[model samples]
Target: MEFRLSEDQRLLVETARKVGERFGSAYWRDLDARKAYPAEAWQAICDAGLCAIALPEEHGGSGLGMLEMALAVEALCAGGAGSTLAQLFMLNPIFGGVSIARFGTPAQKRALLPGLARGEVTFCMALTEPDAGTNSLEVRSFARAEGDGWRLNGRKVWITAVPQATKMLVVARTRRVEEVQRRTHGITLFLVEPDRPGVTHSAIEKLGTNTLPSSSVFLDEVRVEPEDVVGRVDEGWPALLEVLNTERIVTTAGLVGTVELAIRLAVDYARGRRVFGATPIAAYQGLQFPLAQAHALGEAARLLNRKAAALCDLGEPYGSPANQAKLLAAQAAAQATERAMQTMGGMGYAKEFDVERLWRDARLFRFAPVSEEMVLNYIAVHDLGMPRGY
Candidate 1:
């Protein structure tokens, strides 16, 4: 029932905030304009060991829990780099390292975890295909059995960090659709090396979060050894559920951070800008009320995010809460960003103002990880005990 962060957690958040502040909004805006990666900022976070906070100490990490990771992400967003940078760091722990730490074979962990902890290697998940947007169960990618190994063939679109990733936690079907008892069954997870001969990637021109790479990945008969299988073959649907829930929670944490940043920017601008005769625009109720409302919504979303992360760390049943957190946080972030843009008036449309970039970045939250519609569906069935819509 403890609501406050521990002293150590507070320190972790403060350190992340300092690192994020060093980069500044101008740096982020410039990177977005040039469509460049935040290599320096990422390296700084690595040097601070923030990248490895959730990894086990044996793997050269601090072995922190998901709550600490969420706090760090929120702090990074609040410090001004926006959600794009927060998104970059949040994935390393939840989607990248957690899978290896939990399901990877001993040899796999020995080979990958240490390097991942040191940020020497980065990973991205390949789940969504051109055909499998929200209906991930309809994945067309197949992994055919080959002499004590497998050969995977598929094209995955909207894969993040593929160009920079050394490994991809790919989900592919091993058994044909008719062979499985259920549609969700017969799928398998594989940690495939992206640098292999059969794999090729092309970057996509994206609207926001342009600093981080997002590309379409083509896998042409990529060879995978037996050791590459994560968890068990044809039982990957369950493993993927775990990964999805974790992704939802962590991604929402980053969005909560972005909302905080947007609120701050709006407040600062309102206090500085003069509208009528003498006082600042913030003196008027019109400007102040909306900013207050944004702050309240952002705070509520932050609480929900922390609650979801805590449940995840405790190994509690978190699927519903995770979805709820993501849905609420993303909605709050999008609203806040839009309001911030409006609060800034003409300057908000300009890239130099930074809210314009945040506005673009906020739009992605409503669509990625899981969409708002999907979250509502989950709640209707799982939380409300309603009949399945689909």
Candidate 2:
């Protein structure tokens, strides 16, 4: 890859950043305090016509690809909304819409894409079960073929944005693990309406980003028609991989972008804050060097994320790169937030400064979508050709 953005890409980034700043950090801070949904921010993002950046132009999108999507997300996070707005992007654009655009049958596209492109539709993924955190293949959710449809029954935990979303991308096992030749064989993906007869959600109290709620979703014999399947039944693992990898890119972009926000918060605070003999805290090398190192790590992760997204756009093997990018992005964001809080001293713990909120939000990145240990395991086995850890 050229490792540079085109003129049009720059414009997209600027526009997204402006939209994000229109809400600003104060807006997000208040939302977290109130534990309110970001209805106004969501509508504003939809009004900007930014949701369809990764879909084909024929489907009311910009005819762009994953790299552009990541760019827009990064700019939005940097603009000031942070991961709060980035999660909004994750629900509609990256997870639900992009996969449907790529793999959904024509009828499914016609039914879903227009609303998705306009941001009229919302989605929450029902991928994680209580017992199947990192080992998704262990999901006990079963979809049994009956007559012309399937009956889905199981529970999903830690699902995000469940209440507001019109749809849920449910992952279930179409066949028992022992019945399949490989552990991955039975996994299937379906697009089910959250309001369907047998589905329910109970919000899970979480750490931060209260603006976007997480929940436990219950499914009891939910009826799904053949048209609801995103890809072939029991052949959906590949599509699932695509969805997950894109999520990594989207999330990595947001984390990378928010590094700037956190760093700037600390830097500005340090420059003006003074205690000992009128000397500012910014003069201290102890503070300066860590922030500088955090900046460098953020930049490196951004480059890696871009490369992974570019590979995704080109239909190349990007699993290793995407996981690597996400791993670095998580580390970089965590470091930035921790350092920013350290720089703010007592103010960092105070909600009024907003670095504390950023700190709380960034702390979850290393665990979700994938974990740091899992990424390291993958790299050790796949990239470095080491034996898989027992």
Candidate 3:
């Protein structure tokens, strides 16, 4: 795999970095404290056309690929805007736009995607239920066929960007579990207008990522029209899986960037702060080694993420590579953030230094989108050809 970015990709990264740099740590800290969406930052990204890089040209985007998307997100996080900026910018395109571009009818694409490209609309994933967090195959949200439409009834939890989203790509069961020959079958995808009647949501108070809201969505017999279906009925599992690699790859890139930023902050603090006869702590091997090790791990994770994203852009099979990248990047971010905390000591714990905020955001990746244990399980079963354990 090539280590260097293409000229265009480099330009894209530079543009994203500039956008991110416009928002200072004080801006993010205030928003995180208020648990409010970074509306101004999000609008800046949209206005710069970064949000639509992956969309097709006809829909007013650059018609780029996953590699370009990942590059932009990485730059955004590395510029100190962190993962909320990345998620708010990319979630609609990677999760919803890709699915629509690939599977939607021409009418569906025309009706929804242009608004997405213009950032007039935001899309959130409404997949996880109270009982179906990691194991989405067991999702109990049911959509029953109605007269030329459908009626959805269920609850979804841990849905990101709910407050800011205008639409949702909702996954539901069309057939009962016992009726399907396999667990993956009988699932369906629907494009839902979230503000319509019978649809209600509340923001979840979480440990981190306060700049964006996670929500619990209640779909109480919400009506969906026939044109809103993303793919063929009872075939949503494969459709959802089609975009999982995109989601994982972009997220891995952001995590890598965040970890790199943590390492940079730690190293800078260690070098400048003097202790014990005016000696820089960075001179001590004890403080230096862990940060160095974290840097190595973060670089390795970045390489893996690059490879996975490149494969995605090439239209090659990238599930294993993307999953592995997510696993490594999450671990690397956790370690790097923790090391940054230890190096900065009390200052790191304080909000002004920004390491504490970065630390909280970094830890979210270890579980959300996909857990580390699940990635290992996938590697064990698919890569190693072992019997499924769970």
Collision count for each candidate, in order: 0, 0, 0
Largest lDDT belongs to which candidate?
2
Q: Each candidate: what lDDT? A: 0.84, 0.87, 0.85
Q: Model 1 off-target regions past 4 Å?
A: none
For model 3, how big is the CA root-mean-square deviation? Answer: 1.2
Tens digits of per-residue lDDT, candidate 3, 1-390, equal 467777888899899888877876678889999988887887788888888888889978889888888888888888886665667744688767888988888998888888887778788889888999989899999988889888999999988888778878899999979898999999989888779888999988889999888889999989999888888999888888977768897788888888878888888899999978789998989888888888788788888878887887788888998899889888888988898999999999999998899889988889978899999999999999999979
lDDT tens per residue, model 1, 190-227: 98878887998898987888888888999999998888
TM-score of each: 0.97, 0.98, 0.97
Per residue, candidate 2 scores C-alpha lDDT tens digits across 87-165 of: 8877888778877887889987887788888878888899999999988889999999999889999999989888899
Q: Against the true structure, candidate 1 has what lDDT?
A: 0.84
Clashing pairs in 2: none
Residue 78, model 3, lDDT? 82
Arranged by lDDT with the best first, the candidates are 2, 3, 1
User: Which candidate, 1 or 3, would have the higher lDDT against the true structure?
Assistant: 3
Return the TM-score for candidate 2, rounded to 2 decimals.
0.98
